[model samples]
Target: MTQTLRFLEDGLASDQIVALLDLHLREMHAWSPPCSVHAMSVERLRAPDVTFWSAWDSEHLAGCGALKHLDAVHGEVKSMRAHPDYRGKGVGKAILVHLLEQAKARGYSRLSLETGTSDEFAAPRGLYAAHGFEECGPFSDYEPDPFSYFMTRTL
Candidate 1:
């Protein structure tokens, strides 16, 4: 039998969560310049407009993702990351599906995201494409950037 993936909307006050988020930040900076790295800091993810959740398999953290309200009809996917030990186990997909569901529940008409264009990001890009996201120009506060690729899907 498959173990259920538990999504927890916590207080974001735990050391483990902060450490994972910081790891995500470091990875983002490694792949792009400071100007091109759009991953949110821990403090930023605490904003009122952002809703964040972590995926867990029993007591183990599988991954995490967040959705940011851009407008009444638009939402942005943010801060997605699978724990290193959970990389090939559907953790990312689980987090993404949760975000998409949350977006739809909130009546968002569309969802968008920004990710790197490097080879390191091919897997994530593929995952998004498989889930109906299509390549698009930058959205919201973003500008044209070679290091970044944008994707959006109607909800």
Candidate 2:
């Protein structure tokens, strides 16, 4: 099937997005303890400093991600998730690329993210690595934690 994919700049208020965010939060909690979960809530994602994107494939919400401006020269990736039915279909990669481009367009010299360190997150870490993100110390007010894995790449 030839599916049409489009990425929208904002989807925070949509019902489809609400469900996706809920799923992301649930997955995060499932993978780590409460203190280790850094996934943002929908309200937090709607903040002015965050630019959220939702990927749609022929009217289906395939995935979503967000870029949060940490400072004039830095940004952070947040809330990246692919729909259960869309895993391994490049939806997550598409969202990540979109967020990276957005960060670059805003003149961010560095991009960073915090993800879980468990086996469930290995695939995501690999994806980040493939995109040139390397292991790094915590950034943007994040404290070092055993359950959290930090990664960053210079733009």
Candidate 3:
């Protein structure tokens, strides 16, 4: 499939995107403690500091990811999820690559992310690790949480 990644200023307005995000939120809530579920709501993702992107395979949305500017030289990856039907199809990796490129383009010196430390998040953790992200201490406004794993990679 030919997948294209494009910036989305109002992704939450799309039912398809909203549904995917809803699923993501549900999964996060189900797997992590309430305080550990840091997944952003669709409304929060539309904030000025967040740049959201959707990956489309022709007419279908395959995956989505976001970059949240934390500082002049730092960025945080957020809301990365692949459509249920698009799993194992490189959709998530494509979104991650796109987010990383966007961070570098914005002159970020570092990229970081927070994900669950449970089996449910093993794949995502592996994906980030493969992209050179190493386990790190909590960053930005995050605090230490046993259920959360923080990682960062230098740009």
Best by lDDT: 1
Ranking by TM-score: 1, 2, 3
Query: What tens-digit string does per-residue lDDT give for candidate 1 at 12-100?
Result: 78887899999999999998999999999888999998998988888887788999999999999998899898998888888888899
Residue lDDT tens for model 2, 49-137: 89898888888889898998899999999999998889999887888888888889999999999999999999999999999999999
Write down the worst ten-residue block by lDDT for model 1: 1-10
Candidate 2, TM-score vs. the true structure? 0.96
Better of 1 and 3 by TM-score: 1
Give the residue spans of candidate 2 off by over 4 A. 1-3
User: Model 1 lDDT vs. the true structure?
Assistant: 0.91
Arranged by lDDT, best first = 1, 2, 3
For candidate 3, write residues 1-155 as lDDT tens digits: 52454445445678998899999999999999998999999999989999888777777888889999999999999999999998877778888888898999999999999999999899999999999999999999999999999999999
Give candidates' CA RMSD values in order: 1.2, 1.5, 1.4
The CA-based lDDT of model 2 is what?
0.90
TM-score of each: 0.97, 0.96, 0.95
Compare candidates 2 and 3 on TM-score and give the better one.
Answer: 2
RMSD of 2: 1.5
